[model samples]
Target: MAFVYDLCVVGAGMTGAAAAREASIIDNYKVCLVGPAEPKVRKVNTGKEVFGAHYDEARIASSTSSKVPVWGILAERSIRRYSELEHLSGVHFYDSVGSLTVGTRNSEYLNKVEKQANSQGYAHSMDILDSQQLRRKYPFFNFSSEDQGIAEENTAGIINPRKMVMAQISVASKNGCDVIRETVTGIVRQPDGNSRVVTENGRLIMTRKVLLATNVFTEIHNLLGDIRPLYVPMPQTVTLAEISPQDATRLRNMPSLKYRGYGEPSWPSDYLRNNNDQIDFYMLPPVRYPDGKYYIKLGHSDDILKGPLQVSEMQKWYCGEGDKALEEQMFRLLQRLLPGVTFLSHHGDACITMVTPNSQPYVDLVTPTVGVVMGDNGWAAKSSDEIGRIAARMIVQSDWSYDLPKHMFKLYTNVTGPPPASKL
Candidate 1:
């Protein structure tokens, strides 16, 4: 008898890996995951190549959010499960040194974050700190008198995102998931209603259902038909600053920090402070890099690299170091936050993040046999597990499960209600 995969997940990044792994938990169906071995070489929009978002070295994981209430809940659930997942997978990726969101006193953004935490029933996990307290607790940080801190009490820090994806895929493979490391060329529907997944090397894999977690490439393949129009791809960059091991120790206990800023604008456009005036900065504690030297990582809180791009443009951005001006600004921002620390050298990587019309991700069943988990809005690293869980539940069961607030993540419902007040 020929082997037919019960579920075939394309794009084994964070979301695909998690979805495949979660779905594999059920012993009833044979699952398979397909993705590119090297994402940078993958062809995307306009038939050109671009780098994958998960190719980054690290990503921040925290429960604090100034967006919708459900965002925090999803993040909190995933954050709490990091340890258990690490133990089960025998892979250590989560570095739980804690996290902090620092903003000017009376800042509207900070107020919203507090409200979000309260609504999610995890307010106890957060603590407010005045400028004096912030300086006293984290001496390595340089905070202004007007700044205050929202300190997350537990399960917040930097995560090795690539390794986390590997861990998920590893665990899923061990759970009997067939791992296919290849690019999906096309997905065609069969006469009997099943889907046939075609790979780059002219191979056909039959699957009962298909989950497209291919991120921005969803558009490249037109996976969702009309629904695919809802996602927009934007370039994202992160810079790493090499520092001495002594400086790393000095800032070792420093929590993952988000520096919030507000400009003359009466209103903020996007959630992550992605504006010319309201540009925000985020930092992760120093970690040893491949060169055996400790390096601190930083990136803009704003989706500063806005607008759509062709595959060729994205490929150029990924294969090369990011914008020099942005890197300079990032360095200045970091130096301002920690004046005592000195960066010996700087390096960074560029990738793409798919944004929805709303900031929420699309983790819903597009058709009876087609489910999608895309448009992470740059939050996939921390929340991929929950997003994957929702997708897996959809693939396993005929209806939505009560384990998560599935309705909030529905793509069609979100786009029809109202356009996002601001660009994501």
Candidate 2:
């Protein structure tokens, strides 16, 4: 007789791992986490290979958001637990170097961020810096005269997404949750109120309930049967500029940056045009990659593929190098942002963001026994822990027990022309 799991999570990425761990800890349920490991070698046109956005070394983690106050709330909830998770799993993934947000003084975006910060009581932890103060504090950056900054000097910094996932999975395994390293190909809804998950290697597992954290691949494999959640899988390009160890040490105090609005007027007009006249860019300080080199990473959140990429295009996009022209623009922007910073070499990588209608994550159950926790909208890396917790409680207790309203995460099914405008 096959052992039926109390709950089975269908993605082993950050959210899925956190969900599995939380579910096991909540009630000691028989939990199973399923997903393929990162590809050892990223070769184009490979067979059945899947990728996740958490394969990087550094992601900005902060309790300030320009979109909604709820995001800051979620980030604060997760940031408070980084130490506990690290200690329990014996993994170090977070760095408290701080995070900085800059935009024109009293700009609409900065105002929204300040409002959210105040609502979340994060204003006290942050230092508001005028353009002159910013220049004095961080002499390395080249800020426009009108730019004002809000610096979160504590409780905000960077997280190693890969290591964070590992930490969650490590603790989950210690709690007796089974970890399966295989790609989930399909899910069969049994006649009874249960599910049978089928993997690519011809393995089957039965579970009382299912949670899908599959992100962009949620609909690609038809895991939800005929239910198609409205989402746009847009392609993103991230460029990394390798710097010397001396440069890395000299700039070790650099904080992760979120710069709003078009930068220096000298920047290429085509790049600005491609980004829809918006030049908002987020950057991570020098972080060592797997290749044993330190690189400064930067990417414009709005500079993405024009139309929503189809499921067939994802694999190819992931395999091939990202847009070369965009990469050049990012590298040039990085050079301008940090003058006199020389680079050994630079290259581009590809990733995808799943944007939903409301720019919020969907943490609701599609069916009584099937739940979904996806649609990151570029904010999942920082808030994944709390998001996962909400989903786990929903699955384990079989109720909407979270403080936030359930309708905020309500799932939208079928029919959509283009995703609604995003707040981020």
Candidate 3:
């Protein structure tokens, strides 16, 4: 029988969905997305897919444990991509305000951040701020001169993440790609080299090419080890705290920041993002809490994310319940940061990010029958949409060229040959 589709993308997160949506723009090729059964099914029995929970202190600890340079660089790349993608996806990201850093005089990580910004050709706006200068600019900080600070003006801001993912999926589907909401059970290659995706319902679909944008779970099967893919799944946590419209405005106006950490402060960097009436204080590194447990509720806490910081180490935590625990930590952290705000409802979300060893993404074809775009380390604010468009071009075009920088394809290998000669 003829192949069922030109491409099959596993995972419904930003990467997989982006690949599928963009593929439809090609001439007459049929593309299909074989992903989880449901992207947002909140069944108590069904566990978290890509994201899990946000723990304030644990993540800060996690950040300090490994190479801080990697994280800072990824964040910088994300900042640059924001402007380039806004017009293409019609997604609005708030890139107006600068990010403030409030830490100690000898803060190690923040200085590295400056170096990263400089190396990436983005050091133009970073301003070193003393406590007095910070106070003069925004009195809300409530921090003193004992802290060393820097602000990257017009560098970083927030985007409506879930909404942007949906927009890409919408446009890609409208272009004629078939998006299937199903969990993949296994993958097998036929004699002709086409891939067969076995779904949870036992339905099998065949395709000429395959792309694995599965994020965290991508490593669970042949897609990673056999493919020798350069990716890691790390669980990250962010909190959603409900605030009065007035309180929310305070956070909205305030530039988000990373703080000068306390002991083991490495894992619990304070991140400031906002929901309508609430401020989201996300933490990483999954640390150990005061009670000496992995997670807890309503108490002095310090818990670590039980996973690896590098692609070398990764573990999954069902985030639905952990989300509650993470929210509690974020709220407590927020209370310490901004005492005046009160909360209504609090929730946590786990964002599993695919990270490459070098911190850049993998966007190239590794096999004759497969090409992929994966690994962003959760800096999807701009990279996701742009990467999707890039993946779309690589997968759908006859020439395998659609404006991707030449270096992007060279990342996976040194093979300097012409594009695949086989016709689609």
Candidate 4:
């Protein structure tokens, strides 16, 4: 017997999972989710590929954006819907520990963050804290006297990204989505105008429409043939520090912290090759990992370089051993900032995310039969739910009546040259 679906969503990461789940809400449509299993090391190759993006335990979910107003709007929508999503999906994912965006007074980043909050009418969701107020609330931070912060009391916190994705896909499955754990190797358009997705094991899934939420892998695999590159895949490294129960208790009340680094330049251009000083970093509160140890996660915003870092394949870049000197620099900063905080050693891992020129995601139809929800730019977790909802509605309704502005996410085809031969 042949298999067919009304919609097929590729990539089971945050966007794909949520899209599949959202599309399956209606009983009339048949939706199938085609994605790869987690990538792993092996002596021989299997068809399965790991989604390195969502492998982490915690991701910052905040409505307060230091970058753009649209992001804050998207984040606020997603954060507001999280509870409803959890209730409907019957899976818990948000932590609601609150979050802080700390920066020096008159800092460019903080200015943008405050502007977004005020412009988006979400200023009530956060409290702007002067350096003294910030110190009073969170004394652990070693902020300069001129530092200021924004406290998202309820609308921000750390999220279990893996569980969030699982809950979404699980809900999709319950809602009648055909969940296939196989990888889609190729997509071909049929004479009848339907799209046929071919799996590595020779299984075929025919569908009227397709949503590619493959994130960095979208570019890595060139899944949309001849579709101009909408995003560039870049490698990001995260450092993890296993903490003791006592340390966790001490830091239990600490919100997820986004510090722009007060006294030094932490941006990518500051220290691309050198790692002697700490770069700007986002710090998550201690969360229990699969190993049963509580660990705090920190990731640097400084690009591995100032420009986009190209990744050729998904399997080639999964592990993030980290730059030792950089890790040491981070450790030094943590010690100076949070005195007496215990660390049970540390390690690093790398993940890839699609970064657009403007640091926004693309949520437009690439081809008539294909739509995309890629280019997360590292904010996919908090924005996944809303992004998925938008992508699904665009495909199913075939209309643009979304509540959020749809102009920024329109597809841009900049394929100036010939397409690469077969691989990303």
Please report, in order, the local distance difference test score of every candidate based on alpha carbons: 0.76, 0.87, 0.53, 0.76
Off by over 4 Å in 1: 39-50, 225-227, 262-276, 403-406, 413-424
Q: Model 1 Cα RMSD, Å?
A: 4.2
In terms of lDDT, which candidate is strongest?
A: 2
How far is 15's C-alpha from truth in model 3 (Å)? 1.8
Give the per-residue Cα lDDT of candidate 2 at 87: 98
Q: For residues 235-317, write the lDDT of model 2, one tens digit per residue.
A: 88889999999999999999999988656565545554333465788999999999999999998765455557889888888
Model 4 TM-score on a 0 to 1 scale: 0.90
Which is better, 2 or 4, measured by TM-score? 2
Query: Could you give the candidate ranking by lDDT, starting with the highest?
Result: 2, 1, 4, 3
Q: What tens-digit string does per-residue lDDT give for candidate 4 at 1-424?
A: 4666899999888889989989999878999998875654421154345454787789999987766466777888888888877887788889889999987788777888888788888788788888789889997777778778889986688888888988898889889898888777888899988898988789988899999887766654457876766566666767788889888988888899887744432223433332433346788989988878998887777444333555544454564354566665565566555666878888776677777766777888766668988878888789889889999989887767787667677665575332243312
Q: What's the lDDT of the predicted structure labeled candidate 1?
A: 0.76
Q: Once model 3 is optimally superposed onto the true structure by TM-score, how far is the C-alpha of residue 59 displaced, in angstroms?
A: 15
Candidate 1 TM-score versus the reference: 0.90
Put down candidate 3 lDDT per residue, 119-160, tens digits, no spaces: 656667777877688777766545545666666566554444
If candidate 2 were superposed on the true structure by all CA atoms, what would the RMSD be? 2.2
lDDT of 1 by residue, 239-344 (tens): 7888998888877787888877652132223334564455587788898865688888888764577557664476666666666667766776676667789889
RMSD vs true structure, all candidates: 4.2, 2.2, 9.4, 4.5
The C-alpha local distance difference test score for the whole of candidate 4 amounts to: 0.76
